[model samples]
Target: MGVFPDFDGLGGIGDLKQVIGALLTVVLIVAVLMIVVSAICWALGASHGNPSLASKGRIGVLVGIGAAALAGAAVAWMNWLITLGSQL
Candidate 1:
């Protein structure tokens, strides 16, 4: 048996899963957009000698990429934790 609780036989969760998938897709798209915008902002700030704007843009880019990584890895991380717990 899997380490995860037996939600396999549960009814109606398919819809919830679909919704979650859709939301994840939306988040990914937005995060990518943010990264693009931040890159442009950083370029403009550097060209204009605005350190503050450049810093903010760099931070935004990092945050957007971090969020995207988390969203992508959450399920794998959760499964890894569960497997470790079961093995212990």
Candidate 2:
């Protein structure tokens, strides 16, 4: 069964697929924005000799990138997992 129940081809919104697609799009956009902001913060921190700020920015950059990658691959990852699970 699909994780989201369809109600007249829409799952609480206009089409479940469209809702998920929009959500993923938003996530990607936020992740890209985070990367840019973090990079700027990293540069500013390093220039001001603030190790704490720099470290936080660096961590944010990494996490944002990882999140973006995961979101991008979520569909493929889910399909793979489902296939593997069915085999087991």
lDDT of 2 by residue, 1-88 (tens): 6684443442243354466678789999999999999999998999999999899999989989999999979856655755564454
After superposition, which runs of candidate 1 have C-alpha atoms over 4 Å from their true positions? 1-9, 75-88
In Å, residue 71's CA in model 1 sits off its true spot by 0.8
Give the Cα error of residue 39 in candidate 1, in Å: 0.8
RMSD of 1: 5.5
Show the colliding residue pairs in model 1.
Answer: none
Each model's backbone clash number: 0, 0
**Candidate that would win on TM-score:** 1
lDDT of 1 at 31: 97
Cα-based lDDT for every prediction: 0.81, 0.79
- TM per prediction: 0.72, 0.68
